[model samples]
Structure formats: C-alpha cells, structure tokens
Target: MTAKAKYQEVLDLGASLNIQNGDVKEENGTLKVWGTANTPYEKNLIWDKIKAIGGESPSDIMADIKVADNSVYHRHTVKSGETLGKIAIQYYGKASKYQDIFKANSDILKNPDVIHPDQELIIPNA
Candidate 1:
C-alpha cells in the first residue's frame, strides 16, 4: 500500500483526538506524522492505534507526538460514574486532590461534584 493509504487510519485517529499542529508527509514508501497531543494518554492512544494497524512495532511510520502539557500526568476524558474525587484518587492517589482537578477544569466544570461523560479534564502535575 502507498504510505498515505497505509497510515490513513492513523491520521484519522489523530484528527479524532483533536491533535494540534498535525502534519503528514509520505515519502519513499514511508509516512511521517507530526502532532502535539493534549496529554500523554492521548499520545498513547495514537501509538496504540498505530501498533494495532502495523503490529507491535511498525517501521513504516514515523510519528512525532508531543504533549501539549508535559507537566500534567494525563488528560482524562470523563466517563459515566466518574467523580472528581474518584479521578483525583486515580491520578494523585488521594481523593482529597479533587479540588485540584476542580480548579484546573473550572472553565468548563461548575461544580467539583459534576462531570459528564466525554468531558476532557486535565490532570495537573502533583
């Protein structure tokens, strides 16, 4: 397959993740991808998709995935049944740190107790 065609899914995956500064180039039977992911988790999601398409390690693709917020451990997309304290415990190992997450996401989150599914939240650096 042409490099473009071979990595189409990876490109699409990057778009779905809202990658910033995304660039794609196909040359000499290889695809080069560059983008800044919002978080390490987002970067991993892209790599996971790449490996799933090209096996454990794919030589056909080169990806430069930079994290937008290197200080934060991860960017978490909220799910049903997830609370700020629950998320805090997952990242900070202390449910009390929910206030930190609440302050970090105050732009979209009005209350610490409320978060909806698919709402992206930044897990700030400890």
Candidate 2:
C-alpha cells in the first residue's frame, strides 16, 4: 500500500483531535505527519493510534507532533484520592507546589484541598 494509504487511520485520528497546522504527505514510502496537539495526552493518542495500526515503534510513519502548550508541563486527569498537592508532587517533585497547580486550575478548582475525579487539571510550568 502507498505510505499515505497505510497510515490513513493515523491521519484520521489527528483530524478527530483537531490538530493544528496539520500536514500529511508521503515521502520515500514513509508517511509524514506534522501537527500541534493541544496536550501531551492528545499527542500520545495519535502515537497510540499509529502503533495500533503499524505495531510497536513502527518505521513506516514519521510523525512530528508538538504540544501547543509548552508552558505547562502536562495535563492531569484527577482520580480518586488525588489532591492538588499529590498531583503537584507527581509533576513538580515538590508537594509544596500545590498552590501553583491550584492557581493554574483556579477556573475549576475553588480550594487546593478539593479536587474531583475525572477533572482535567493543567500542570503549569514551574
């Protein structure tokens, strides 16, 4: 199959994610995809789709996926028993940085001690 055809699923996945500045081209029998994802999780989703279709570490597709928000380290999907301090420690290595996380997600978070499961929080730059 042509490179573009081989990786059509990956391209479709990118579209579903609303990738910005997306470009798809076939070069030397390899599918080349370039785009900016809103978050690291979204970028990983694209890679997961590519690997699902092509196997682990597929050599047939070359994807350049950039995270749009470089200022933030990554996004955190809150789980049960997860607090801003706990999440902060996971990304910032210091539980004391919980205030930063609270400030970053102030739109949804009213208190640093209270966070609900499944809430997506932005882990801002330290």
Specify the highest-lDDT model's number: 1
What is the C-alpha lDDT profile of model 2 across 7-122, one tens digit per residue? 88888889998999999888788888899998776787888898898999888889899999777767889999988888877876799999998999999998888899999998
Cα lDDT computed for each candidate against the true fold: 0.88, 0.86
Per-residue lDDT tens digits for candidate 1, residues 1-126, read 787797788899899989999999987888999999988767877998899888997888899999997877698889999999899888777999999999988999998877999999988877
Worst 10-residue lDDT window for candidate 1 reads 39-48
Candidate 2 lowest-lDDT run of ten = 39-48
**N/CA/C clash count, model 1:** 0
Model 2 regions lying over 4 Å from their true place: 73-107, 110-126
RMSD in angstroms, all models? 4.7, 5.0
**lDDT score, candidate 1:** 0.88
TM-score of 1: 0.65
